[model samples]
Target: MRRGWICFTFFATLAAMTRFSIPSSAIAVNRSGSGGPVIVSIPHAGRIYPPEILAAARVGREQLERLEDSWCDLIAGQAADRGATVVQAVWARAVADCNRGEGQMAPGEVALPLRAQFSAPGRKERAGLGVIPTRLADCGSLWRFPIDRHGLNWRLESFHRPYHVALSRELARARARFGHAVLIDLHSMPAIPAGQPGHGARIVVGDRFGRTADDRITAAVVEEVERLGVSVTRNQPYAGGHIVSAHGRPDRSIHAVQIEIDRSLYLHPDRSPDHRAVVRMSEWFGGLIERLAGIAPGEDEVPLAAE
Candidate 1:
């Protein structure tokens, strides 16, 4: 029963972040026991898929596997115990990428195409990595049969909408409890060529070119993690994805940062992750949360431990 349960050291300062109860299921969220300034989002770390959709996808059990969040959930799951609320997707990313805008539609795709003009099919979509992937990596098709409108709606209703409803609710609740909130949209990048630009930093901290969030919060997160001896970079490779574009608004005092961790750090190219290395990374993140939790929007609060 250790599917999603993990333990961590607790601190009084961490008690500031509050925990929220969600319906019990594979997708259940584990909110921080304390109220803190940070909210960690693990959008792509899902593995559950509807039976029908799985059957339609022509891929073998292992072949369809390439599209998983791998172990991103286990790493980010630690956030909930460290004064940061964690929101994760229970349905598989192949069902729908929570990081993507609502417009993503795959024709005969399992999910109903929303009634909106999405960004035209660009690199991410053509390569079968859009909000709703049409294919898998290496130019592989995911479906044995074409998807229809009704089936798409079924997935939308059963999977997509429910996920966002939970996510939006969590964000709203956090903002209400705390004067301000910060969302860390967590994801993992393939060690191989994902077609994302730049050499790909081990950890890419994105703030949407300084538009979505404040500079100070961004600086604190990036600097704290880098101090842990990990190679970190800025907006070059990942300048935040749909979650950032949707929820990040520093003006409203609800900030979001997209943290893209390189898969190679913890996983091999074959898609298997090293659990011990992942825990090491997670422990480092715990220390970072301890530091970020002390951050103050105004000049009054004390600087972080290192400062």
Candidate 2:
């Protein structure tokens, strides 16, 4: 039995180093809802991979898909039913991660024009989880060779930039309709292994240690998730990402918060969600959105300047 498990692991890792052909297209941003104060950004839920990317990739489809926050779109999609705007990327994160900043690249790495100013590389980037991932967990490297400048540029222009543009547009629309807007960046994390420090926490709420969002919003989210009988944590393991840092401006009345749900809550072993689990989680998310939408903008909150 031990030998069989070892062999399976080996083959899975080997399989992850191949490629799969896919249709050609830029990143697709699926949007819904008329207008609301809340906007949900599910940046890592995308599964589509352009053929060009697949052709150049050293990793297989399974490994790339493993990087996804699987089924997060379905959870965040519920926000739309509550009249909140939803912006989700359809291009896989391995191509270009919308949650990572442009400058989160390794030394000598080439990429597109900066959409935002540079910030110091974060833990994720250092761990090979950047705008364009260079490696996968358990499977060492993701690329057979360094990506050429032109290919990097294509990913930036075709996938990364478009995803951010759509998200910004939705935020702008939400702010225009409401006095202020709050962005709920939805994601899912792997379950904590037994005996880990955060093993008990099923949800993690990150607001960049209060820099990216208002305290009231974060507190309310923690409260909501805990009420559902899920363990919750704050600013541990995760504390927001590039999306929250870029768009969160509480003083500007544009708050952003990152919510990380434990994958075990909704996903099966294969990373697909059971229908009953999905429905239950979706209902919980819908209620959470409604509550968040009702939060009155703080005195410091101000409408975004006309772009």
Candidate 3:
């Protein structure tokens, strides 16, 4: 409910001066400081949904609830204070996932889902992590019946569209002001998948195999967090998702990297609260962020300006 504000500064020969103004309210934009070449986006943290769609959900409230990134907002919510704008989604991922590409297909694709439903290619779709998930975690069947085409369209219009629109604007603003933009897509993942090898490293960074961002930028972020006593790995169980695919255009001077923090490091995967770890991790992230903010622009590895 708290809209972000933006600070702009023109560093000419004049002494320190900055412009503070209310950002566009069309979508929530939390402004922190003047042009800083960084934009932190949290697409999976939204929890709001339209009343009508919530009533029509095939899955029970509890099942839909558990799929959330869970406390992601609390982790990176203060990005605005560190000279970056944080564009957080307010709607629940169950309502519509902002990280998913538009028109992502589900299991019963040939059945022709309603216009509102999203259909797309990518692991999120194959893994049932679409705009409307086919399953909750590994559990079966979130929907009781096929969603009507008409109903599907409503979800897109209400939830999916607004979040992306807001993100696009912020990214554009960052690009305009700083001549480059680095979008840090922040998220959290469940530790140790069921029946699989445990994740040896706690923080996983995804740059789409170096296609989504400049290698040096990714290295800088990874190196900084690793210095804070956090084990860092690159592109393993989780690579970049839709947000990375859609916005990461290094050739265009916009670099995006997906940072997945293993939840076990901070929270009890058994769904219990671990306030101590959360606090420590949160503090560690704040330090890591400062390192990211300190990265200078115009590196030889920085991507060329986009067309």
Best by TM-score: 2
TM of each candidate vs. truth: 0.81, 0.82, 0.79
* Distance from true location, Cα of 119 in model 3, Å: 8.4
lDDT string, candidate 3, 34-152, tens digits = 54667777777666654444554555776777877877777764566656788887666776677777677564631353433444446666676776666655667665445444344
Where does candidate 3 stray beyond 4 Å?
1-27, 107-123, 194-198, 269-273, 297-307
| 65 Cα displacement, candidate 3 (Å) | 1.2
What ranking of all candidate models by lDDT puts the best one first?
2, 1, 3
What C-alpha lDDT, on a 0 to 100 scale, does residue 67 get in candidate 3? 73
The number of clashing residue pairs in model 3 is 20
lDDT of 2 by residue, 1-307 (tens): 4543443344334334432112234444444444568888888988887655565556688887888899888776577777677777788888888888777766423323442332455667667787788787788777655544545555676667777777778777777777678899999998867887567799999999999888988887999998889889897768888899999988878899999999888888888887788888899998888877777656442222321
Q: What are the per-residue Cα lDDT tens digits for candidate 1 across 94-160? A: 7667777656654333324432344366667666666666786574777653444444444455555
Q: Residue 197 CA error for candidate 1 (Å)?
A: 4.6
Provide the lowest-lDDT 10-residue window in model 1: 3-12
Which consecutive 10 residues in model 3 have the weakest lDDT in total? 4-13
Off by over 4 Å in 2: 1-34, 108-122, 193-197, 299-307
> Best candidate, lDDT-wise?
2
